[model samples]
Target chain A: MPLTKRIIPCLDVKDGKVVKGTAFVNLRDMGDPVALAARYAAQGADELLFLDITATIQERKIFLSLIKSVARQVNIPFTVGGGISSEADAYNLLSAGADKISVNSAAVKEPALVSKLAKRFGSQCVVLAADAGMQADGNWQVYVNGGRKNTGISVLCWIEQAVQMGAGEILLTSINNDGGRKGFALSLLQEVTARVQVPVIASGGAGSLQHFADVFEQTGADAALAAGIFHEESITIPQVKQYLYKQKIPVRL
Target chain B: MKLVIVDYSAGNTCSVIFALNRLGIAPVISADAAEIRAADKVILPGVGAAGSAMLSLQQNGLDNVLRSLQQPMLGICLGMQLLCTASDEDDASCLDILGGQVQKLDAPKIPHIGWNDVYDLRGDLFKGLPENSYLYFVHSYGVPVSRATIATAAYGQSFSAAVQKDNFYGVQFHPEKSGDNGLLILKNFLNL
Candidate 1:
């Protein structure tokens, strides 16, 4: 059967500009997110993910308007997450042109909320975002509230519950390698992808095109999501796909 | 009067946009309820999980909006998956606009990623293309060959490479990356 491999560009939005950094802090401005999105869309990116890295519990509605504006400019599908709490909040993001609403901290707070949104909007809309920080014990621990607090649940187990509760996809981020250019934690990806039936987007630790190829080949992930490489223009989506193509890994060129 | 790229977050739409622009067409990217309905022709592009893409559509209240459109709508990749009744990705329940299910390839190489050919063509998207026209493809899941199928492709198994239903059409391959064949497909779709 024919299935298209996805090439996704991630934008870390802070006050409407795409930003990037290492280990989730000390961010620097990249460019206008809307323009970058348009540029990526023009370059053949499979999709775009907008992470409201600054969408603290305080400033939210502002993010929605940004999402709305960004949605208006581009013709491809985009996902918005960060500071999303209630069903209405998710609905608003969707209303603003967000094709998907990802739940991380909120889902951890009220585990049932995943099912609620999935039931109300269908499972496909709800994404379970698991921010994994490696513990001394070698377990990928789940973090919530913008990676400020650690949820005691195992990241793998939390993802499993989220799927059972009705999440359509899992966006897994590795704190150890996020923006480090050390490449993805294929081991962790192997663990997560083996268990979940849903599409798993491998985030964090992407420094090169081969990193993406390795993620799909080694971990069996459906898509590879990265921020810095794309934000810095280190590697373009077409470049990544073309690299994958040369490797005999099927991509849309 | 112009090519309209449907902005549902079903997958990567940029490739199509880039492809069209390379072919000298300035396509409009839209997700607004009104704009997409107003476009001369529409292309739905997608990647990622099928169920999530469907949710994105419904969350934006776009499913109904897309279903009611009179303009030609072309679904690409997972965008194609969303047109069906269901898909196995994330155990999704799709738009049911086209009666089919997007099933996982599940072969030894799980996500079948590579170049493949649309063995035979019978749709407007490939009007000037020849039989077994090769196009770029990279996916792990696919829509089963059904009544909607208009073209066939081979990877590990034979499946619906392209489909047409009413004004809605779908392609399993990425014509944008397939050189001249892809450009011709874009021209054909815009004219249809």
Candidate 2:
């Protein structure tokens, strides 16, 4: 049997509460992380991705608590990312209840961190979250520090290198399509999925249910992730799964 | 009934413990031989490489305890692979309670990190779950089907999704990480 395409709900967490923004700006509070996670899990979300938007040493302590509390409330696989620089951070989060640790800027700064976490905890636990945006040259560039800086690294090259260094899953978020709600960058997703064999999670646009179907049909991504739509309750997770099932996508309802 | 989750530093015991707690089954996470041996039901939960996990079990001397376990014991994920005779993961020799070799999956994906349906189930571990019910899986290596095979899944080839021999039961997927169907599987195991 074919592996079912996954529908994941991403929570952009800041100050221990779920938040969402457009074009990665003007953050708005959504709700408590623990409650939202429980609801999503019960709603049949295949997985949940928590990206800690807090960017401080002191606030990260609060974020850890949120991770622990949310993990306790849900049974599905969840990933924790944001500002994780070393193995200690990864270790703390995994022990706190995160099934996977996603690294973005830290991995871009030092690729060895990916290999270190993958080796110590196993590759299945290490996820490479790449934020890619369209460039004038018709190739995507990798963004670091939560889409604040461009590393000038080609997105395709970085994905290949990350996978080789032992990143088991790749959370590919298109910067240009992020919060745009128009659609996912299917071409970029298709390119990355073609380049790497690991499961790729396409994040960014996801305006309607059809977008999810488009990503799955057009690309080889194993999953699709969205934040604003899920947080705003514009469409419920079960609705998405029902739609996928009708489209013959083999979703777990 | 007392339940003990074998904790050999393989990682991700919190979710398993939490899931059992939600089911009203408070599990003790330990490497102590007496606790594991005395428990009514034991869960061997693991995540990571087989060689290192086996070494950790040996360091704690839980390897012998597991092999000799008479109570119904269930292994999840890497723990399931470790129940086999050996694995290509670091050329690791395992408990050998289930006579099969764990080999790397020959699939388009290496880790198989998503939900997949398990069909052809034939045991009490999956008592209430319907056929073709999806269970979350994340692993690079798996034990092939054998006399102990109870259920099988296909990624590129058919491998044991669930295995059984005497009172020993092992599932290649993570029931704790999986959703309600997974919780049902855990509930069935607890009842068994």
Candidate 3:
């Protein structure tokens, strides 16, 4: 009867196809993005995220077409991330039927872009995809350019700033936990969720069903996103929801 | 049946168009008053802030067209909020089709995004859908439960998930993106 915790299945897309890799490297073809999205929606995925792993200017047209195709088929709300820098880019994607447009590297390069997008499209349309890796000093540093370049900015500080700039949702992905499937960065998520008033979606390091429950039960994360495990058929969305439901975590079944 | 999705440039009209396409109905997306009035049913789909959306509707004279419609009209998300008497989002006065005020949700999360169950179903909109069926929602402001409320959902408090008064109907959720259950609701609206 309450708002349920979301179980999101992510599709790392490249060349209009779904790809999976570890730590954002060693890419391998999984399947067509549209087919995979439809399958996950049927399996009761709370939401779907499609990140263009190789997002380029040339690939922009391809990504838009892909979004249109997916929108035509899949019925669930979805967000698309990667290479979205300007307001026009975000508008194009939203017009093409993306429920939300996520920004990571772009927001870091120009912090005001978050506010601009949010103002023009409303906060709910802008999702700040904050990717970070833990440092030796135990602080997390924000990473950009698909987790290649480090901004040297504290992840905690950056997320707070973005939220103030009108980011409606936070998609916090731990670069170290990504692709490793160890588990979510629970502490980071807990800290970020506690700091921001918007919904926080925890990404990276979702290996097992318990990881899904742990993130929800331990932290105030609104959603948990996993890519590889679902792509490999090792874990299904329904299985994860069923597990979370049993754990007393409210999930839509 | 002729159906038109009111295109006020404030909502996800494409998704609503595709949802109807799946149901074998190709709805005409229009901002023209005549086209909308000509249709058997009209869907007012909206997202984003209430003030600007109201401005767009008033600028294009859709505010009056929507208010005068004798046929069934279904408003989605912010479209639904615009049907209320007023909204707390921008202190904006709405179309006043429905007798209530849209206030910001008193939840821990501001926007209240993602799926939630809609219980206390009534009217023909939720026909065939099970009680407490999960529907996708992404909004911050909602109309508190009132006499016209046909269905209810809770985030931090109980709010109107679906509301109807004669020919005017509104849903605070995006049924177009709510998968099967949402499509079913759209179908029900079409049948009405």
Candidate 4:
């Protein structure tokens, strides 16, 4: 038997709070990021990714204090994102004890930067995050700034480009499916996974553990990342994994 | 003696320590050379890309400290990958602490999420774990299944799920987040 990838639950933080809504709005504070992260860790969340959604635009710190506290408390791999425009931002997150730094808007704006960091720090240290929204033409277009800015780049094409530029992994989130919890956009996932060689983490539209199994079994993505459900305890990571085990989809127990 | 978790900027040390306490085994989080040297055992937990993590280890001079430890050591997730000779994630030149290369999990569907089963359990870690018991995993790349693989799991392909070589043991999955079976596997590691 070989090694399997991961299933992660994400938390989008803005102004020192965890918030999630459709198309990235309706910001309601859920709980402290550290407490929420620890709760998820206890419930079997494989890893945690905390994104400081507003840090980049304001040039403020990307929730370093929250990350530090979470690192102090949790025992799982943690990736920090949002407003991560510079290598310094990446370094700070690492210093705060983040395992990985996720870049989305910045990567699309400056493709060379991803490689530069990957060259300096290593590709595994840089994760390219793409907020994808299906365009009217049926291509997945990349969006940024919480799905507000359209980069006019095809997501699959961008993924290939990022990988070529030395991005170790791609955190592909579908604005079309995000917060819908209606299951992922299978067509979108299938397309991206087919073209990208690096790990593709499927984000958005996860309502049930079966939704996770459906995406992993069908799309062959390296991992499935969800937020609303995991945060609200609609489904626990353990329950999802147990169901996947029953489905015979390989998970690490 | 309390379980000692090595802290070298890798994020998961505290979580692993908490997991130990939950299993009724309190662990001490330490990056100090002397504390690690004096501990009964050490578990190195990490996440993120390999190269920088290696740099953090080297910056703290833990690279040497970890390699020299005679006590039982279990590296988790990226911790396990760091022990390997190399990894595809960052073209990472790893600890070379263990043989083999960490390869990319190139597949149709990725981030292989959810609870899947691990098979070919080799040691006490799987004692109470059901045949194919589920463990939590969240990684982009993995060390190629090698002689050290104690168990295996399948996604787009089967790969190393757990590894054991001498005093060094590692699991790609998060036993801390893996519920009872994960706790049991962790308990087994503690007993080791």
Highest-DockQ candidate = 3
Kept native contacts, fraction for each prediction: 0.04, 0.74, 0.82, 0.20
What would the per-residue lDDT of candidate 4 be over residues B1-192, giving only the tens digit for each residue?
A: 667888876643555665677677878777899999888888888865787788888888888898888888989888888889888776878888788988877655445544567888888767767666766676768777888999888767788889988888889887765666777888888787
Give one digit per residue, the lDDT tens place, for model 1 in A92-189: 78767676778889889899989988766656557788999999989889987767688788998899899888887789999888878888989999
Residues B1-192 of candidate 2 have per-residue lDDT tens digits of 899999899988999988998899888888889988999999999888999999999999989999999889999989999889999999999999987889999999888888899999897888888888899998889888888999889998888999999999999999998878889999999888
Compute the lDDT of residue A228 as modeled in candidate 2.
Answer: 90
iRMS, all models: 8.1, 0.9, 1.0, 5.5
Write one digit per residue (lDDT tens) for candidate 3, span A2-118: 888888899988998999888888999999999999999999998899998876777878989999999999999999998889998888989999999999999999999999999
Candidate 1 root-mean-square deviation in Å = 7.0
Question: By summed lDDT, which 10 consecutive residues of candidate 1 chain B come out lowest?
Answer: B106-115
lDDT of 3 by residue, B120-148 (tens): 99989999999999899988899999999
Q: Please state the error at residue B61 of candidate 2 in Å.
A: 1.5
What stretches of model 2 exceed 4 Å from their correct place? none
Looking at candidate 2 chain A, the ten consecutive residues that score lowest on lDDT are A64-73
Q: Write the per-residue lDDT of candidate 2 for residues A72-183, one digit (tens) a residue.
A: 7899999999999999899999999999999999999999998999999999989999999899988999998789899999999999999999999999999999999999
Candidate 3 chain B, run of 10 with poorest lDDT: B4-13
CAPRI tier of model 2: high
Native-to-model Cα distance after best TM-score fit, residue B147 in candidate 2, in Å: 1.5
Clashing pairs in 2: none
lDDT of each: 0.78, 0.91, 0.92, 0.78
Q: Give the C-alpha miss distance for residue B135 in model 4, angstroms.
A: 3.6
Per-residue lDDT of B158 in model 1: 80
